[model samples]
Target: MEVEDQIRRIMEGEGLEFTELDVHPDQAKPATLRKTVSYIVCAVILNDQEEVLMVQEAKQECFGQWYLPAGRMEEGEAIEAAMQREVKEEAGFDCQPITLLLIQEQGPQWIRFIFLAKVTGGSLKIPGEGDQESLQATWWDRVSPLQLRGRDILDLIDSGLKYHQETWHPRTLPVAIPCSHVVQRLVLIFSNAEEELWVLLVKAPRLHLPTAGAVKTHTLMWASSLVVQDALGSLYYDQEVTALGVLGLQHHYHPTPGRLQSRCSDGVCFNMLAQLVPDPVQRDRDGEKLEVVPPSQPPPPENPRYTWKRIQSQATAEELFPTVAPTSHQDGQRADIGAATVAPQLPPRPRRLRELGSPEAGPGAPAAGHTDPTAGSSVALRPRTRP
Candidate 1:
């Protein structure tokens, strides 16, 4: 079955609504050219001591050089399945992915999916008789020098460490409803005559960004737009709304009585940055134009709910809304000015499946491990004990 057809069937089975954002042909890279693209999935498995797992390749070209447990994707296989299979085969551990860390693409030809995974079962070991593709698997402190298979992997390792330290954002999903599962908010930024920027603040029950609850039938953006309109009034109804980027992520957790905890127990809030030209059309009851008021002023009686605070610095605005900056490619065109449009359904690209009997084995093969010459250096190799 076609991929899109399969996706549609799954969506239908799950009783989910689908929407597509229209991308102009000129803006979209050609899909036909990407049919031959290859995908590589890598797993970053870190132990409690901040050590990373590495595998040595048996392939002649990079013999004895260490790298992450990674491999190419097989036709008809799911992404998570591919990651599990690679980690099991290369590192000798049956693992489950914790979350997707990164999805890096090079043009339309090469794509890599990096995942953070935790070991669930299976023993670590060196490659035995039938599996010669890998020489060894071991845990490394990541500080010692070993013959690395590729120099580029070091950058990826750094990214993995950074992700482990500070997650770019909380794990979020496009939910059909705003359950306690997720916290959502919208940000409105404006500029004044001096080009100084300000952020809209609400003085309702507390001083906080405008909050919106996601609905079962609408998209997050749609729901957030509604909240913006309702909170700010009709002055912003006709303005184009564009999401700049994610402002920040906050995870809420119930506190324990004695010991401190870091994990969120309640829910996670995903704050989206929205930008618009603050050209107000409505006037106050006194017939005065609704100009940007000082941040300290009490919410005006007419619209006694909203106020604007001048941003501390230009650098602050750039940091919060990086996409607002103009680029050389956008010198003559305004890329940030347009609103998103819903497009008609576009056909899915044709999938190019790898032949079953090709020299390269499918990614679904049984798990195996490798042994490296550097296995003796600070690297620990724990073999699975047989029953």
Candidate 2:
């Protein structure tokens, strides 16, 4: 399959990926429900009147207070499915996720998926209809005189309104590939000075992109560099790994309800773009020869279990690699801002995905509306302000 097309499919919930934690399984703490990790899904739904969809707390600690519809994800439940279930159970309305608006995390162990959703059908659950899930559901104007479960959701509501006003990133939803643990599905790439693109793939089980498990000691994004550091050995520090942005996510509830979920994994797989970036500081430090110096490529890994496959399709290459075009100055001189000295392709073009900067997003999280970077596993998630 074409490389870019495969990614598109994954984003649309039509594709699947195999976990590669076996490559260095010891490096991660795989998801095992209440054991290694726990996932929380929160929904932020807004109505035409600019009011927010909210439910009164049913839990004794905060009874009759207002909050967004959210709940603990079941051991064997899809992320979106869990969100929908919570919305219905709490709000008494059917809803669908528009996109994953934010990711908040206390590391991957305690993560929350926040989404901007739309009410599809159903009436609000009135007072008597309240059950253990909620006392009642209602749409509240931010200015209304309502007591809240917590003030924290104020930021979340604002975040939702901001996204409703302007969409800062692509429409991202969960990919439905079954996984037994939490992993980062890497579109890990290395490029030559000529912009010949290649992706890293795990050779075992099947020839697929590498999926690194999350190590609780560090944030999930660290998984990419960890694998690189392990596989590349001495070459690890010569180049930097740039987390471009999250392309999509994969999650599904695959275990039987009421069954102990400890045996199976209910973690998410973040499909992301991470590139091995070579440092340019020493590009001319080696010598003062006036001759134009060509850049060096990261050497192939000595590990036989890993392989780099070149991208032969030009269209696929462009989707993965950012591009720069010449723009004319007021003086009529055209200059290319990208570092590449050549006509096209290579690293450090302008980025469209902003860093979410969530600790869950880990390292180079984009500030745009996104997760897989942190709204994010960092999704710590002081509600993210839209850039």
Candidate 3:
């Protein structure tokens, strides 16, 4: 009758192993959860001159000491709204959060969200009406030392600066297609011979990668495993499959025609490479024989949803699987492992694909200006002004 019970029944009916990973969040007992936590939002505002914004607290204990524009979240307020409100009240600037710089949590009792924001409007030192908590709002060069309200702010400042310098990952948002969050996996299934690589292509009105949604209850590996199982049935039940690395990060935006489009208007899909070993029971199957198997509930003939396509050449494989490299023996000697002479190296952790047409593309690309909008450069630091 309960959600978890229903999930268990479905998994048993579908011949799926009922592991902890198959449990969805909604199916969990809310009464057993930990107590609700409080949140503190902080904003790291930087001007064109690379000056950091700071406010002198009016409180007696740490009065006149400088701190970032930060405050505790008010009830019923969103995290972004809290950050913006703090920045306006403490720094006198109406800023827009560019990206989440850092998240610090001491269990669930105290959590802090730090954001890197850019000034959009309002003047410096001119606090919004009724803002009286800070004695003064000013910008600091950071190189010059000032009386800091708390030492923890130093780490936050460093994180903000590093995030501004080099972004290790892209910002992601919840899916806008009638779901708070959606987990979809794109798999790159390869042949056992290593001579060819195969990917599941879905032709649902348009040709695209085969993807499975509604996997928030499972790990990325487990979710991808479901996709493989749904498409290939029990053919790979005895085979060992490992997620190699991420191939790309596809942020699907809504088709709505507008300049102010959100990054995750439609949903986000994580394209990952999965290495599959030949099932001992079907070791003799050739690459052609192991073509993609469609889901049991197949799409219409005109909108075929799953088909396997062999990668034509090694060059194409190299392009698609950039992190994957075939291992070679030294001095041109061949190293034999069973029947296979070469082995593919284990890929490093997956990295998100850089967005197309970015300044990071090439040397001739123009530097991204502040006015250009969108998430800006990860490594380029703004010019500093000597205090």
Candidate 4:
């Protein structure tokens, strides 16, 4: 219930939903760094004059071109450590991450953590005194002509600017807790036309948020939809599952230079809010659009293992059910409907995969056991170490 309360307060106050992790302390997958998954970290740094920081590429492919100070995360290293290391190596500055500015996912296999960081020390890299990391680093005035390695960073720079001027999203960073794989602790929500909202919870796990492990082939967000499909079965096709954004993240890696290890130790877990909406294109046997029945509540999930818990707190419900103008994919036009959305139909159902939680195998957090914090945490128990 502590996890539930934590989620409730955040939703009721900030419109950000916190989810209980589906990841247990210990799991079956080795999830070792570099071997199973790889991550890229990007830094968005700005000066008092609002010039963006840029680094010249030294790597063979994009040599001489400019890009953000970014690089691959090394084995068993924390997210912040990786970010700072990249900045120091590529940009020649010591920095601290203020908050997670953005997260770009290519699925379970590839992920990028973007941050807005402020410099703490070190001078900018110059052409003569640099290693293979880069030729030089400088703050770009935006108006200056610069050859860019990729234009994809243009949006990342803009996101940093928007965040610097005024706070839009909540301030979020990776917590210290260790996880074994790329997993999601999801706040899955369903609502009616009347705006009443219900959250999906796992029944056997003592009524906690549904957690899903990432599949290598699919995007990280697809894990949430996979949860819906498993819970709803045949009804999945008519539903749309989309992950809104991350609320909390966990990453931990201890640096031991000469240590020989049996497995890679890097792990990160993302806590996110995902939505399940009805399919807009519902048709009857006569080819006429059908009015989705009982616009008052969500349909029951077919699997008894999952249940929809109605949010009694109106404040929390409102946060969970934020209003966004629905759009049509058919003609790319505005959806002509109220908040009460239609229900689902899947063109193709993804195969059911096992949940990430399993008996604790090696070291670190143990397997799923109890909710009691007194017993233990990081292994066998849910996270009570909320910072």
TM-score of 1: 0.43
Candidate 3 C-alpha lDDT tens digits along 145-187: 7998765566556656655665643442112221112333454
TM accuracy, model 4: 0.77
lDDT of 2 by residue, 72-152 (tens): 877667889889999999999999899886665544666777889999999999989989989998889888799987665
Error of 2 at 152 (Å): 5.5
Where is model 4 poorest over a 10-residue stretch in terms of lDDT? 373-382
In order of appearance, the predictions have TM-scores of 0.43, 0.70, 0.42, 0.77
Model 3 lDDT, full chain set: 0.46
CA deviation > 4 Å runs, candidate 4: 9-28, 255-265, 285-288, 325-387
134-199 in candidate 4: lDDT tens per residue? Answer: 999999998899999876577668768867885655566777555656777778888776667888
Candidate 2's displacement at residue 194, Å, is 5.4
lDDT of 2: 0.65
lDDT (Cα atoms) of all candidates against the true structure: 0.46, 0.65, 0.46, 0.64
Cα displacement (angstroms), candidate 4, residue 219, comes to 0.9
Our model 4 lands, by Cα RMSD against the true structure, at 11.5
Superposed Cα deviation of residue 146, candidate 1 (Å): 0.9
| Candidate that beats the other on TM-score, 3 or 4, i.e. the better one | 4
lDDT of 1 by residue, 1-387 (tens): 322232222222221111111111122222111243345678889888878899988777677788888887665445578789988887789998765544433222334556788899998866562266577798999878888876545545664675577554333222221113233455566543344565665665444455554332233334345645655565554344544443333332234465344331223234455555433354668977676542332122235576666566544444333222211111112111112122123222211111010011112221122122101001000001111
- Identify the leading candidate in terms of TM-score: 4
lDDT of 4 at 244: 46
